[model samples]
Target: MTEVRCPLCKTVPEHGRKWDYGERTTVQCAVCGFYTITGTAVSIAERQNISHKLSAYTRDNTERGVDVPEINSNNLSQLQTSLPDYGVGDKQLLYMRALERRSKFPGSLVQVTPGIDYPLAWASGEEEFLYLLRDLLSRRLVAVPEGGTKALREDVSFETLITPAGWEYLEKHRAVSAISDQVFVAMSFSPNLQAAWEDAIRPAIVESGYKPYRIDDEPHVDRIDSKIIAEIRNSGFLVADVTEQRPGVYFEAGFALGLGLKVFWCVRSDDLEHVHFDTRQYNHIVWETEADLKEKLFYFVTSVAGKRTAT
Candidate 1:
């Protein structure tokens, strides 16, 4: 195997490997992990100078052990737009979540190499990752060995443990619906939109390995508002289709967001102009046909929530 510069970060990873198969190249880099990139995407990334962001995106996903991301010209722009804009606090929380995921049990020691694991926090580099670790240490949310901090500062690998306080913090901040396999659908219930629900929304959720729960789908004796609230609380995430500019959809989507549950927004292409002004800024999957909505929604669900494990 010959040394090859990582197409995304332009750095030669010490443990990286590259394999060329006709038009696409598969690269496994210390920074970007494993990803396959098409010839067109490599050129586009260079021309747009978005390699750093792309590297972080790929690295983050790779760390999560999800489907290996393929960067092709068709989806490169969309992927760039979907890259998270994590703030300092968000990054800290993300880092903590990463640590929690790696641990087999509470207080288990998790080894980390900042240089390679920085992207787990969506951090720009090792410096920012160390800054986050320092903050966690200061807050006593995580504990290192007596001299582990100094070793980490020197860019040495070390195992850090999440303290009891860290467990408590995560428990408090964790989403109530994190364990659920149900995805709530908040959309217009008009007769005109029935086909959209049956043909696109429901099928997409099922194909993504999650149950779709819409208010009208199940019989309930409770008041509509009460049942809606209860079901939303039990949902893992939400799909809010604002095709008819429904006020209830907006309220439900907002409620889910307040609970820290992910909400995917959607709107019919023709109804795009009528979406509420406040939510206009959010990226919405605008679809011209049911087929388009089904495809996009399935992709979004699998990308964000990941496919549920089969029993």
Candidate 2:
């Protein structure tokens, strides 16, 4: 009828297109690419179109669902009969990405290393991310309750319904294809941090022979932390580039320690100035140039097998 709202900028537009999901009317903005999904006018929800949001979330919780035989004591004996062959959820997507780019060396799954740096994947928290794809294939609505890089990951598989609507959404978006599985030098960065991070550590981390990973799963799609946690925990050594005094980095460091892996810490001097005495006093590497970070990170990371077991 009248103009709907824009998806990128949620303002009622002079002209837009209305896309309906049969039962509901979803509008897309012709001028600004904003649209409406579900019943929400969508302007109240800036950077979100109504129709797009509707596709992602249910009218209730807005999470994606999985199609598989869920495990239950009532039917435990039929495990094999229930399990499917390929349930490539987010983690498997990450693994697939890791596999795609990794060198064709034996022991690659464990040793090929990663390529992108997706903070969301890390932010998925431990339990939620551990062996996540496998869980997502079998369950639905894996959740990160705390809402940050350090929230608790809990699977909501038990309380979901597998719907064809979600599969349609996934097919249209190819959310599976967008995850970044490359290893990155993590820093609490904004636009300013990007330059500094790339300049100081990005190349070096790459030089140190790590492929970074990024997670770009659609919001309602499954976000499993299983394989991620398993990879990080089982990693022979972890290097936390603590350039920023971030709680999430500390959480990952603690996770590394809990796993009893060798942790190579790094920080910029200015940033290092702000770190707590407990962290500052620790034997962390201080690097001003990529060469130094690369030299040291490579020396340590490459020597992990000789220095530490792949436990």
Question: In model 1, what are the clashing residue pairs, if there are any?
Answer: none
Q: Give the TM-score of candidate 1.
A: 0.57
Worst 10 residues of 2 by lDDT: 111-120
Candidate 1 lDDT tens digits, 1-311: 88877787677877655556567777778878888888789999889877766777777657756455578897687566545466787678878888998999987899998877787777877898899889998999999978777687636799999999998888765743344678999999999889899999999999999999998886655458756765775687999999988899999999889767889999999999998999988899999999999999999899877877666
Question: lDDT of all the models against the reference?
Answer: 0.82, 0.40
Q: lDDT for model 1, on a 0 to 1 scale?
A: 0.82
lDDT for each residue of candidate 2 in 1-311, tens digit (9 for 90 to 100): 75655433344656655555432334333222222333333333333222222212211111112221221222222222212222235444433332233324422222210111111122122343445533533443222222321321242322122224433434432421222223423356556456545554555545544553322211222223432343443343456777768776666667656644456678766677877676666677776666676666667555542322222
- TM-scores across all candidates? 0.57, 0.35
